[model samples]
Structures are given as structure tokens and as C-alpha cells.
Target chain A: MSTLSLTTSIVDATGRMLAKYTPREKINWGRLGVISVPSVWLFVFFFVPFLVVFKISFAESEIAIPPYSDLMNWDAEDTFLSIKLSLANYIFLFEDALYLDAYWSSVKIAGVATIITLIVAFPMAYLIARSEPNKRNLLLMLVVVPFWTSFLLRIYAWMGFLNKNGLINQGLMAIGIIDEPLIMMQTDFAVYIGIVYAYLPLMILPLYTALEKMDMTLIEAASDLGATPTQSFIKITLPLAVPGIIAGCMLVFIPAVGEFVIPSLLGGSDTLMIGRVLWDEFFQNRDWPMAAAVATVMLVMLLLPIMLVSDGQDKKEEA
Target chain B: MKKTSKFLTSSSILGFLFLYAPIVSLIVYSFNSSKLVTIWGGWSIKWYGKLFENEQIIEAAMLSFKIAFITSCLAVILGTMAGFVLARMGRFKGKMILSGWISAPLVMPEVITGLSLLLLFVALENTFGWPAGRGTNTIIIAHTTFCLAYVAVIVQSRLSMLDETLEEAAMDLGAKPSSLFFLVTMPLIAPALVSGWLLSFTLSLDDLVIASFVSGPGSSTLPMVIYSKVRMGVTPEINALATLMILIVALGVVAAMVIMKRQHRLNKELKE
Candidate 1:
């Protein structure tokens, strides 16, 4: 009993000592450890890169190795630090019809492709989500399996299928559908096909997740109340799936806007994408500032739609 | 169960067909004995054999593998910390910036990302005189930036589902915070880390445009090699390469699924 009492007193003393240090104080240091490593790394790599791009966009292209004029000119003579900023790069993008057309075409193509994806993915996702429990996982897995395959290779697969002498044309010719090949590849049609095909999983998975978790009882109640299937779907299912729809559209649209691989591989030379334009400016034309300008503008173009989407979602939530 | 409508069922079938047909054709044509890609001569493994004999492809694959291995390791470590912050840390200063920087990479255009990273490297080289020339190092860093976000999202989702009471209990039992994390939290989130690592590995391997912007002479990745070749035109050898990559990825996906299912079952059993 004496030994037990001694141990209890020691334990009690330690407990008091532990209580002296609030968990918040201890967790603050822990928070710093967790936050600093990744945040600093992102700041240096992710955030700093954009800042560099922004800075470079303000500088002019030069013949020197870096191919861009320094924004801040430090003159060693007479204690001078001169900062030169130019809007010429941004102005040049406006002056060129090529840049304007590329930007517009990118938005149109991505927007249409996103709509197609929504039309294609919604029903398919619904099919999987509404399936028997045993088959639901398998169905969803099948949808995502192709996403794991190499993205370039999948786009390449479309190239093989859509080429002039490619499989589809060859098979069509063998059956004597037309004397001429359909001229499908190196066209906007092929670009659309590639984007839709490659990004299908992204569109489907989100819709499936949202649909699967939906309460079935609500649907049954709507039906019991003598609402038409279409009416019930419009009122209940459509509104409920709005979050998934928005998520899916953004996923499909964002990368599709600045696509290089699909457009370059399967698109005609005449088909202009901002990504290809940026590549040409930076690599082919060796104009780093112009490329930075193109990228900055493209980022703004991408963000506007996203902000609007989020804003609309916010208003809906408030309502 | 509600009967699936005919339209939905048919459309789903068509979707699967659209997704699988090209891949199936690619796989089937990989074995074509004829040099022509579309022509189906009797099936043979000559392209696969030829692929092995090519020195350029072999070296490129090795370099890609090395880069991917390094990228995944760095991404997982840094990403776990980011994920912990997102999931565990209450509101903090600069959380807005942190969240934006993290999620922005997920949907950001590859060209923009690639361009910005390349510029950052060039500026750093000019100012700090480090990363002297772009090569595998630059590619790995660029890849880790995006892959880190992917991992953080995965790990964050996993952690959101985690029970906090267990950590509280561990602390109450006199476990130090560091030990509590390593012992209690790490084990629970190990599966996410493994999957995140694998995803980062594949993403690094598959990247083309970003690697293109940052890569220097003699350090061409496999995708870079393939991109140049495929740009000229499709080749039987590329079909062979595509076939091999698909097979490997399919196996990996199946393995991941099995592991995740087993983990779920184990969790359920433990709860019971």
C-alpha cells in the first residue's frame, strides 16, 4: 500500500507537469513543422515560378543567352539602380491576331468539349452509381482503369485510330464506305475526341461519387407523389448533381484549354492552341517574354470562368 | 435495385467501347509482323524483341525510371507534411495562399506550369548560380511540384476520415506528440503514402511537355523519345512500347486495388 501511494504521487506530479503545458502550445510547434516544410517548398518552387514568369513578362526579349532583358538594371557606375518595365509584350499579344484567335479558339474548343463530356459522363456515372452494390465498385474501377494508362500513349492510340491510313479508315475502305478516307486526323474533331476520351474518367468519377451517396428515398418519395420521372429528375436529381457537374466540367475544361499533346499530335498545323503557341514562342521563336505573356493571359482566362463557377455555387448555397 | 434505363445502359456500353477500343487496337497491333502499323500480318513478338535491342529507348527508359523513383520519394515526404497541415492544422496565417498554391497545380495548364518552372530555374541559375544546367534534376523538381499536390490531396482525403480520439488517447497515456504521430498517425495513413508514391512515380514517368521544357541535351526521358518518334508518324515499335506500358500500369492498378480493399477489410475487422 505504501509503494502504491508513492507511485500514485509521482504519477500525479507528472500529470500536473503535463497540464502545465497546454496542448495548444505543443501543437503550435507541431503545426510549424507540418506547415513550414511544404509551404516553404511550394513558395520556392510553385509560387516563385509564377512570380518569375510575371517578372519576365514585364521584361523585353534580348539576343543574349537568357533571351530576356533584366527587369532591374543595376549600373555599377555612379550608384544607380534602374528598373525598366514594359507592357510591350502584353501590347504585342493584343496587336497580333494570331494570339487573339488562339485564345478564343482555345476557349471555344474547351467549352464545347466540356459540355460533351458532361453529356457523356453523367449517364454513365449514373449507371454505375445506381448499379447493384456488388457491381458498383467494378464499374467505377473500369471507368478509371484507362486513366492509369500513359496519357501520351492513350492520345497516341487515338492517332493510330484516326490517321488517314489508320485502322478506322482502312476498315471503312475495306467495306467500301467511301472512295476517299474521311480525313479525320489532324483535325479539330480528333482533338475533341482525344480530350474527351482522355479526360472521361475525371468527369465520371466525381459524378459517380456524388450520385452514389444520394439518398434513394427522396427519389421514391417524388415518384410516390405522382411526379413524372423527368420532372422528378429535373427537380431532385439534377440539382443534387450540380456540384458533380461543376467539378467535372472544371476538370475537363482547365487542362483542355492549354492542351499541347493532343493538339500537336492529332491536330492539323493550321489548328492553333495557346499551348502550341507558347511552345513555339519560347522554343521556336526563342521569345521568353512573349511566352510568359501568353501564359499569364492564359492563366487569367482560365481563372475567370472558375471564379464565376465558384461564385454561382456560393450564391446557390446562400439561397 | 432500380432497373437501369436502356438509354443509360447503352450509353455506358458505348462509353466503355470508346474508352477501350483504341487501347485494344493498340495492343493488338503491337504484335503485327508487318512493318506497317495498321496492317495485321500474322501475330509475332518481333517488335517487342526490336524494342529491347534499341539502345536509345533502353537508356531513355532507365533515365525515366531513375527520375520517377527520386520524384516519388521527395513528393511523398513533402506532401505528407502538406497533407497534415491541411487536415490537422486549424486555420492559420497564409492558409489561403497555401490552399490556392496547392489546388491550383491540380488544374493548372501544363504549358503554364512547365514554362514558369523553366523560367524559375533560369532566373535561379542567373542569380544564385545553382542548378547550372537543366537536366534530370530540373525535371524531377518540376514533377515533384505537381506530384506533391496530388499526394497532398490523396493524403488529406485519407486523413479527413481518420479518428482524432485515438491521438487524444495516445497523448493522454503520456506519449509525446512526435511519437504519437509516428506510431499512431503514420501507420493509419501508410496506405495513402504508398498509393501517392506510386501515382507520383507514374506521373513523372508519363510527363512529356513539362519534361520537354526543362530537359537538356542527352537527358531525354522515354516519353520525350516516344513523343519525337510518334510526331514523325506511328511506328510498330511505339505500339510495342505502348503495349508494355499499359500492361505494367494495369498490373499496378490491380495491385493497388487489392491492397486498398484489404486495408478496408482490416479496418472493418478492427472496428468489429
Candidate 2:
């Protein structure tokens, strides 16, 4: 590799001698060679898997013995071509109201939860960010510490808190806040609570970064200009923090859209989300092709937020 | 006159209460001695004791730790390398595609990722007679795939922020590229590596949807076990386990904060 690159560079310099283009010796081809190994590793292990998923989504589902089919059978031409690739799965997706309903419900739930999460997390993250420098780290740690535990465990903890005769209801009834239990568990409300609760940190972290990096002098200058606190916040603070806010929203909104565990654990039977539907199709219903179609749709829906966040982060980092 | 302070105090307090109350109640009730999960007949460590005695839960916890440790290590190694390349290498053919692929898993829902991976594994097994079975190995592979993306993003960002002078200086001093990396670049990015490893470890341990989809019948992680137990019936033992996890996590966070603080102080002193 080195010899080839060296010869190429030597030739390039000579080749470009009369071409008026400058020659560069340090091509960093060696670094690329080293980098290529892991790049290929990710491509094979991560990228190819998704490609296979895309391929399978266009194929007809076939039943076989438990687990999967025999390995050697794929080598044969007849068996290979017999797999029958087509768009039947995509057509099936359009025909299924359940799949579409689940997708809509996922959007609604995630949308509401994201709004509520921003409302709940913004003030706290703001206060923490604006706090004294010595205490700032401690406060940030406190916010993130909850996330260090199992995300699923946090959702499960809500089970005890939301169960009928659970602490929240029992306390409410004892205090005469309500005449009856709120029926908090196994409801859409419960699913919303779980999602917001689990993803709150994700929102806060980016918001905190944005807020903490803002110049306090700007707010002070606005105050000096006789602007009210709320005015200063809306004009100076919020606008400056828009990138962070966008980043945070993108982070929370994308994953929450396809969130399954929270809804499955906390949602009632009436609750419908695409993730749950996808899980049912693949695992319970044993409809691999249809499930793949659902996943493909999710992949498309998820692309927007993913692009938004990645671009937002890149801009923030560059700035 | 003092309305804003009062409102701020009240609202902040309310927010804290809302966030911490459910978790506190869950922790407190784990000590309840009664069979009824909701009722607080008395405080005792009986649930914790029972949790220890449950062989299945214990095995699951051990299995979870094993998987988390292995997968996190694998993710850090693969991800750090990928990160280094993306951070250091200038634009090349397929660079955009490579970067997009790295970000895909981070945004993809766990269920979709799980299903897709399962399909991939089945396809490979059918094609090449390799990875003949699905179980622990498959679970590890699936987790490493997703977790590697996260680690790569973190480490890549850190690497991008790094001063390029050190590596250049090392290279000019007659050090080989490989030696320059091990001596200077690695040390400079060590914090990001540690952060990546911890993040991956936490993710692997926290995962349930992907693990459930990919894990074979006999190889259940702690979260999987807890999920099944919760589905079967609410158990105080789960609360006990959760509370213990909280304690461990809290300690880890506090330690991390202290280390970061010390490092910051050292950097300041060096500058002075």
C-alpha cells in the first residue's frame, strides 16, 4: 500500500509538473488503509443487515421448521430463486388499517409527549445551566444520574406507582383529591407518562448544553434595555437556543415515534402504536414480510428527524 | 414584588417532586413486608432477601452483566476505530454514505433494528451455513451493531474537538503513524473512549426489546427476566432489584462528576 501510494505521488508530482496543479505528498493513504478495516466492519455488520432487511421486505414470506430453514438449501439455484421477491408486503401494509392506525397513534403519542417533555425539562435545565459554576456540574450529574439506571427499570417502577391501589391513587384517595382511583395504569396516559419520563433526560441534556453555552450578558443587556424577563427569554434566550431546542426535539421525537416498550408495558389494549403492531406482526403473528414492510415505513418516517438532528449537531459543533 | 422568585421556587419544587416522587415511592415500597405490592404493612428487607434467593433472577442478572461487559468492550473497540477515521480522514468516496450508515442505528427504533437483525442472521445462516444458531452470540452481535453507532458518534465528536498539533508533532519526531496514535492520540482521546465504553455498557444493560427479539430461550438478561416477572405479576422483588440498580447508578454518576471536576481543576492549574 505504501509503495503504491509513494509511486503514485511521485508520478503525480511529475505528471502535474507542466499541468500547473500542485502536488501533495502526504496523502494519508496509510490512515485510510487502517480506517478501511473498521469501515468495512461496520458496513458488513451494520449496513448489510439493513440492506438484507430491505431485500427481505420485498420478498414473500415462507414457513419452515422452528427457528429457520436449512443453511445449505440457499446454495441451490432452485431454492434460491424460489424465495419469490415482490412488493406484496408493501401492498399488504396499505391494506391493513391496523398498521396505519398504529403508525398514527405512534405519531400522536410521541408528539404530545415531546411537547410535555420540553415544557417540563426546559425550566429545570435552564436553572441548572444558569446555576453557579461549582454547583453546575453537580446539578448536571443529578439530571443524568437517573438515566444511568436501566431505562426499562424506570418505566417498570412506574408500574408500582400507577397500579390500582398504587401509591399515587391510594394517596390521592386518602387525601380526598378524587372520589375514586384514576385508573392510571395500562392506559394511553400511562404510556405517555412512561415515554416522557424515560426520554426527559434526552431533552434536558441537549437543552442544557445550549443554555449553558449562551452568554448571560445578552440577557443582562436585554434587562438593561428595560425588557421584561419573559421578553428577554423569548427574544434573546430562546432564539439563541433554537439550535439546541431543535436538536433536543429531534433526538426525543425520532425514537419516541417508534417506542414500543413504554406503550406495551403501560398502554391499555385500546392503545395502538406502530412499534407494537410491528412487534405483533413479527413475533406474535409470524408475518415476517409484513413486519419488514412496517419496518421499512418506520425507517422512512424516522429519516427526517435523524437528518435534522445529525445536521443540527454538525452545525452546532462547527459553530 | 417578589412574585417571580416565589413562582420560580414553587414551580421548580413541583417539577422535582413530580420527577422524584414515583421513583421514591417505588424504592420505599420495595421494603414493604406485605404480600400485596401496594400496601405498606411494615418495612423489612424480606423482598431483597427473596430477590437474592430467586435463582432465575440471579442467573439473569449475571447473564446481563456478562453481555453488557462483552458488548460494551466490543463496541468501544470497533466504534473508536470508526470514529478515529471519520474524525481524521478527509473527504473520500462513499464518505457521506459511511457517515449516514453510522447514524442510522442511533435513530432506528429498537424493534425495527431487532427485527432487521434477526432477518439478517437468518439470511446469513441460510446462505453460508455460518452463525448456524441464534442465541447469546447473536444477541451480542445485534447489540454491538447498534451500540457501536452511539460510541462512534461520541468518540468522533471528541476526536474532532482534539488539537491536531500533538499527533503532527509526534509524527515529525520520527514516530511511526501507529506509534504516534498509541502514544499521543490515544491518550488525548482516552476520556472519550471511557465515556463511549460506559455509554455502551449502560445501553446493553438497559436494552430489552432488542435482547428479547434476538436472545434464545435459555439466555435471558436481567431486564428480560424482570419484564417477564412484571408481566406475570407485580413482585416486590423487582422493586428491590430496581432500587439496588438506582443506588449503583447514583454512585457511578457521583464518581464520574468528581473525576471530571478534578480534571478540570488540574487543567486550570496547569494553565496558571
Candidate 3:
């Protein structure tokens, strides 16, 4: 019968495989192989580098090949331990107004940019979400396709638009609105424009996802009870979209805080973002320990937002 | 109600215009004959010729493409494995730590990630004498590390949505674990894998900050080259390059959308 033939084939397969390992051993090995590759990779590349930054932050700067003193050294007679670990770099960060000012400005700029992006993106997301179902995909694609182009190029485009002889200025001049071209390039205004433009897509996608999934009955119910459209939006829709807002704001804020290219290319000497500071310390000043300290401080500052995002993900999964 | 709807439609149109105007201008200026990007002269394609003639740009672009291709492949393999374990593997020791490691890159600031990886490369070179120097290899590794997180998220979501009954039935029919995976699970997750690959590819290609940190002399990626040139000022040649990039990306996106729509229609018809 078929059963007998199947049993015979199973036994033959087991007879050939059981010589090397059991089924349980095979599964365990497979599982280990699956997990170890990424685990080892993350530990070596991601986690260990963080520890290195921490380690380097404590060492003294030196005009040497590695550019930092060893954390520990031995005396010539080998009788004493010479520890070179110092808080000079961190102390320098605290003592310097440049570093403090950079941090403050970075927070202010990124904060304002996040608000602007959210305000601009919210209406678009709501409109797209409320559109006819068949048209929603096409609208969403329009928002996202621009994101596929090079970010650097898009930021570069803003440079052309915001320059003194740029499009905005030229248009204003042609319309006789101004006698002189506006000094928009290399100003804080330019920085804000660049950040908001670059990060708008990131803001829109999350908002759209949340809004599109929202039940329409909530809004309908509110309207049925005589709440005006604006009142319903402020009271019902905005409150319900809190999760998306938080996600979108975090996405915009965190990266914007450490945004180097925008501030470097678009911002003038007045805009001293922490990322630009870190870059100058590392590349221009050749101060590795100082740069490491800056990076470490930034990581600490960002830990809260990162935790909130991950925690948000966990809550969603649980729900 | 009618007023609100009209307002919403106008706002949406304006929002999209804000998004597209700069790009449209960049493309338009690429055709301008003037050396200055803002000024309008006669139309010309001379910049496109210059863009192609630049050996440095060509080399950097080729390198970027090669790195992106390899990074996406590696990221997919490693990410699929990590995602599979997260979705299918029941609770095990250190699950929290594993998941944390997998997701950390998603929210970590690029500056920090770049600095840490650069430091790691320096340390590795000092200790092992391998990697020899920081360049394409380091950039690819850094890209894979982050892109892996994205791929894992996509694949994990896809896996969670898949029905388990098919795999169970396959096992009940005497399929080994490996055979069950290939015959049942892999085919089901093919779409996720494809999308994951594309996402990773684009991310690797678009990276600038991290590549700036990790790339060495003569190994500058396209973004690095473009950033350097763009910092000086917007030149017509750069505009030409940007125009070409936009055209390619636009074409790719359109092609993908069309294919996805066709596939959706096919599925609906089959169901009917």
C-alpha cells in the first residue's frame, strides 16, 4: 500500500541522515546559523564602535598617528600604571560657548523645521486620505516619487531657488515687488526651507498611513451631531491622529537635529549645527577625542526619542 | 462642506507644487546655455556633454552603483534571516537584545552612525591590518548594516501576515524544515524580498553623510562628488547630471507602479 511505501522511504532517508546528526541537532544548528550572522555583525560593527567612541572620549588628544593617548600605559620599570584617561575633551565641550551655542541652535532650528514640516504635511495627508479610494494611490505616489530623486540634488535645487539672483528673487524683481534681491541664501530661512523640503516626504508618509486607516464614521458622527468641519478636525481628527503626528515629528526632528549637509551647504557662518561642529572637529581640526565626545553627547540627547519610537512600535504590535 | 472641500483640493495642489517646483526648475535650468544656473540664456545640451566627459563623475557613479548592488544583496540575505527568526522563532534567550540590535539603526542619527563606523574602521585597521584602508568596502558594510534594519522590518511585517497553516500542512506531509521553507515560505515572501531589495538599493545609492565619513580618497561615491561640486555652487553640468538622475528615477518608479497595477489586476481577475 501507499503507506508502506512511504514508511520505507522515510526510514531510508533517516538511515542516511541519522549517521551524522539527529533532527533536533539539525534544527538547532540551523537556528544558530540564522541568528549568529546578524548578531555578530551588529556587535562588531554597531555596538563595538559605540564603545570605541566612549573609550576615545576619555583619552587625551595628542599630535600622533592615532591622535589620542592610550587609555593606560606602563612605566619603563613596569612598577607603576600610568593611566592617561582624562575628561579634558568633555570638559572642553562644557567650557566652550561654541559647542553650547551649536547644540542650542541645532535644537531650535530642527524644532522649528519639524513644526513647519508637520503643518505643511498634515493637510496634504488628510486630503489624500479622504480622497476617493481609487485615486488615493496615485496621490500618494506623487508625494513619494520626488523622494526617489537624490536628496542632495533636491537640496541643491533649493540653493538655486533661494539665492539672491535665484528664482524667487527674480520673480519678485520682475513683479516690481522689490528693488533689491532678497538675501535668502546662506541664511536661517534657507536652512529651514532645505530641511522642510528634504524631510517632507518622510513626514507625509506616516501621516497618510495613519489617516488613511482612520474610520470615516468618527468624523461623520461628529458632523451629524452638528459639529462644524473645523471643530471636528480640531477636536476629533487631530486628537485621533496623535500617534502619526508623534511618529512624523520624531522622524523629522531626530535627523534634522544632526543634519550636516543642509546646514553646511545652505546655512551661513551664523548657523552652527552640532553636526557641522562634529565634522569640523574631526576633519578640519584633527581632534578625534573632541569629535568623539560631541558624538557621544549627541547620542545621549537622541536616546529619548529613539526609545519613544521603539516603544511606539511595541505598543502597536501589542495592539 | 463645499467650501472646505474646495479649500482642501487647492491646498493639496499647492503642496504638490511646492514639492515639484524646485525639481522642475532644476530640470529646466539644465537646458539653459548660460553657465550661471539662475540666469536664462538660450537652450543648449552642452552641459550634458560635459557631464559625461567628466571621468571623476563617471567613475564615482559606477562605484556607487556597484556598491549599491552588492550592499542590497547582502542586506537582503542577512535581513531575511534576522526577520525570519524574529517572526517564526518562538521566544528564546536574549530575544530582547537581538531585537534591539536589529532596530537600533532605524532611529540612530546618521552623523552618529557614521562617526562610530569610522572609528570602528580605524580601530580594525590598527588591530588587524585588514580592510587596508577605508573606501568602498567600508561604505558597503555601513550601508548594509542600516539597510538590513529596513529590510528586516519589511520582511518581518510580511512574514507576520502570512498564514501558518500552509507550512504546517507541508510539515505534516513529510517535508523537511529546509524543504518546507523553500517550498512554502520563500515563495510567499517573494514580494517582500523584492521590495526590500529595491528599498535597500535606493538607500545605499542615496546615502551621502555616512559615505562621506567612511569613504577614502579616490573612492568617493556619486553623492560625495555631487556634494563637493554643489557646495561650490550650482553649475549647469551638475544640473544636467541631476536632470538625468531624476529622469532615470522617474522612469523606474513609473515602471514599478505600472507593473504593480497590472499584477493587482491579474490577482483580481484570478479571484473572480
Candidate 4:
């Protein structure tokens, strides 16, 4: 019995020592599997596609199945690889006033909508942030409730409200406020309303989180030091909220520029956002290469803003 | 301070009015018994009754729910793994690229993502002769790619906020790593997983642009159908549909709020 006990204790000691010493050399199959699965999936499905897009952008459009020329060509007669790189699509984009105007108007519309969202969101966020703690959760939840509902439905709601003979016009007529139905649908105004309505929560949530985290006592102290409330707000609150504003604006503006739904549904035929143009070029015109070129250019244009957003996030994290 | 508060109060009220007026009006008009959608004839449930008979909508909704269900489940699995690596795995090779891949989808425009993904599928089919065509499967894949990002972000945050000691203690008690994850870690982060799932479902359900790009002629998603309908014009049936959707969302919100309150109370009691 003693010999058996002694052998068992020795085996246990060796086992513990082996576990301790060999851990580094051991291959963790489980961890490796966890890491590799997502990485491979994302690499194939997310990252490589952008490279494909970039490659396709430089190829010529053809009347074939996929409708774009292969970038690399090999000839059997000669042992040589030739790349058929064409910038014709990009050149076409620059030469075409439609593309230029679409880019310009998309930027303008997105920027204006972002500014409006900010104006509406700030007060709403501030109100929630400064409210009694007991009620803040409910208030914030209310803000998020609209977000949880159908985004399309929210936009569709406005479509009905702003229709020529819809609720707004009917109500106005009943109130003796106007002679004829106001034409609000199929206009930039409608697009702006849709954008602001859809993106308000995006703007507000970040602003609320930022504003709530702020030092309320700093504003109080500034006021105690004989500064007026407006002065305290400008000096203290506004500067601090700049990061939130940037984050919020980026959240709204980045997607807004490439927005397809708002422009198609709300804006008139003359509304020329690049997103719609790309959609049309692909589906309507069947110009795959040209569409790829448009998408590539749009991405390049957005790179600066995207870089700024990431850099801001890094700095915010450091702080 | 008083003046600012007053101004803020008024602006906030206006903002809430701005946020909710259109939706409330749409819901109200859904009940109107009228040929004209906007003009109220009387109160009737005809639209709701008619909505039940719409085969196209029913088919489209079934398709959307099926897609969302598959997408959410796939996303949670892949996303949980991704999030696990991000939160628990120390510095490793390709960490930067992996993280960038995960977060980039959050801000990337739907148009660009859709275009690139569709192009990818075409190229893949050309080469591998798989994913034979764009349809519900393609839509599921596209939605999963974007939805996984959300799940990863949520799960990562939840994991980070969790106390590490609980997990360490479980390990000390001779729990295998796999068992520890399922038994302890998962239960603690179940709320985040649930939120991620719900978020994925809603996002996949509401998606129009990406689904449009990936979906073929026969596989029309609910959003695509609704987009076509809304583009033509508003209908009372759409109003009824919108109202029904709003009701579901409202119910979900209430349930979430109740659960959150209960969680808060439990935490407070534990502290005592």
C-alpha cells in the first residue's frame, strides 16, 4: 500500500511539473481554432473583396458574363505576363459633369443633414444628461425606442406625412393655413428630413455618453468664478463636446454620403448622389467596370474622413 | 442655468415631437377607413384584414425571418470567437488586421460594401463555381458579415467589463477551459449575446441596399418588397404593416427595460 501511494505521488509531481514547463512549447489547438476561424473568414469575405474591387476598377468593361476584363493576361505563344490596366473609367468619371455634380451634391446634402442632426441632437442629449438620474434611463430608452423600430418604416412615415395630399397638407388646409397643397415630397427637403429622422439616434447616443461623462462640477465652478452660464458653456461644455460632435458627425455623415434609400425614396429625379449613380451604373446601365471605378473613387474620397475618425477614436482611448 | 434649461427643455420637446410625430401619425392613419390613405373616412380594420391576405408580403417576411435567423446564429458563433480573441488573447500576429476587419464594416457605407461583396461573389463563382447564384444564401452571407461586427463589438465590451477572477477561480477548481467558457463566462455575458442577436436580427431585417445587391430576381426580401411598394406610393396596407412592426418593437423595448431594471435592482441588493 505504501509503495502504491509513493508511486502515485511521484506521478502527480511529474504531471504538475510537465504542465508547468511544457506550456510554452505546447500547441493550443483550441485557441488556434478560435483565432483562425474568424480571421480566415474575414480575410476571405471582407478584406480580399476590397482588393478584388481595386483590381476590377482598373480593368476594361466588356460585354461578358462578369463584364470586366481580367487584369493579368498570359499568352501561350510568348512566355510573358501582360496586365491590361485601363484608367478610362476614371477618366470618364472626371470628364463627366454628372459624376462631379453627384459627388459635390452628396457631400453637400450629407454635411447639411449632419449639421441639422447635431442641432437637434445636442439639446436632446443635454436634456437627458442633465435630468434626474432616476429618470435618465427611461428617457434614454425612449430615444432608443425609435431606433429599434423599422428604419424604413420611419422614413415611410415621413413619406405619407409629407405627401402632397397627405396628413401635413390636409391638416394645413383644414387649419386655413394655405391655399394649395405644399409640394414637400420628391425634394431635397424630404431627403434632409429622412436623414435627420433616421440618423438622430446615432448623433444623440454618442453625445449623451460624452456629455454624461463630463465633469458637471467644472461648469458649476466656472459659474462660481463669475462667468455667465453662456460663457461657462462655451468655454467648458462646447470644447469638451467637440470629440462627441466629431464622432456623431462621422457616424451620420459617412453613411449619409453613400446613402441609397433616402435619395431614391425622398429626393426627386434630379437628385444625383454618387450612391444612386453607382446603383444606376451597375443595374440600369450594366457598366460593371464603371460602377467599380465609382465605388473605388468614393472610397478614396472618404479615406481622409475615415482616417480622421479612427485617429480621433485612438486619441479618445488614450485620454 | 435657468435660461439654458428652459431653452433646452423646449428644444428637446421639439426634438421628441420631430422624432415621433411621423410614426404616430402613420400608426393613426393605419386605422382609417378610406380609399385615400391620408384622408380619414372613418375607423376600420380592413387594412389589417387585407394585410393578412397579402401573399407576397407573407412570403417576403418568411424569407427575411429565415435569413435573419441564420445570419444571427452564424454571426454569434463567429463573432463570439472574434470577440474572445480580442478580449482575451494578448498581442498576436495579425491582431491589427483582424480588429480593423471587424470594425471597418461598422462605418463602411452599405453601397460600397454591397458593391464590393457582390463583385466578390461574382469573382468567386467565376473561379470556384460555387455560391452558384445570388439569392437568399448570398443575402445571409452579406448580412452575417456586417452583423458579426456588431456582435463582436458588444461581446468584446462585455468580456472586458467582466471580472477575470471569476473565470480564474473556475479554472482553479479544475474546470476545463471549454467547460469554463460555457458554464461561467457565457452565462455572465449572455446579456451581451442576447443584445447582439437582437441587433443582428433587426439590422438584417431592415437592410435594403446590401440585400438588393446580393439578392437575385426570385429572392425578394421584405425590405426590397417594401421599397418597391413605397417607391410606387404609400398604401394603407403598408401603414398597417408599419404599425404592426412598431408594435412588435414597442413590446421588445418594454421587455428590455423591465429586464434591465431587474438587473439593476439585483446588483444593488448584492452590494448590500
Per-candidate chain B TM: 0.99, 0.93, 0.92, 0.95
lDDT of 3 by residue, B231-254 (tens): 888889999999998888888877
- Name the runs in model 4 displaced over 4 angstroms: A1-24, A77-80, A311-319, B1-4
- C-alpha lDDT of residue A100 in model 3: 90
Which 10 successive residues of model 1 chain B have the least lDDT summed? B90-99
In model 2, how large is the Cα lDDT of residue A270?
88
Give the poorly placed runs of model 1, Cα more than 4 Å off.
Answer: A1-28, A174-179, A305-319
lDDT of 4 at B167: 93
Residue pairs in clash, model 3: none
Q: What is the C-alpha RMSD of each candidate to the true structure, in Å?
A: 8.1, 5.3, 7.7, 8.2
Per-residue lDDT over A90-209 for candidate 3, one digit per residue giving the tens place of the 0 to 100 score? 999999999999999999999999999998998899988888766888888889888777888889999888888888898999999999999998999999999999999889988988
Docking class of 1: medium
Estimate the lDDT of model 3: 0.86
lDDT of 2 by residue, B117-158 (tens): 888777888769768878888889888888888888988898
DockQ of each model vs. true complex? 0.50, 0.49, 0.43, 0.50
What C-alpha lDDT, on a 0 to 100 scale, does residue A152 get in candidate 1? 98
After superposition, the stretches of candidate 2 with alpha carbons farther than 4 Å from their true spots are A1-30, A66-83, B1-4
Can you write out model 2's per-residue Cα lDDT over A1-319, one digit (the tens) per residue?
3334335545665555445434554555676676786688778777787787787777666686433322122546555633445777788788878778888889989999999988888887887777777667776776788877788878888888899888888888999999889988889999988988888888888888889889888877999999999999899889987877887787788889888888888889889988889888888878777787898888888877776655554444345
lDDT of 1 by residue, B151-247 (tens): 9888888887887999889999999878988999999999999999999999999999999999988899999999999998889999999999999
- How close to the true structure is residue B14 of candidate 1, measured as C-alpha lDDT? 95
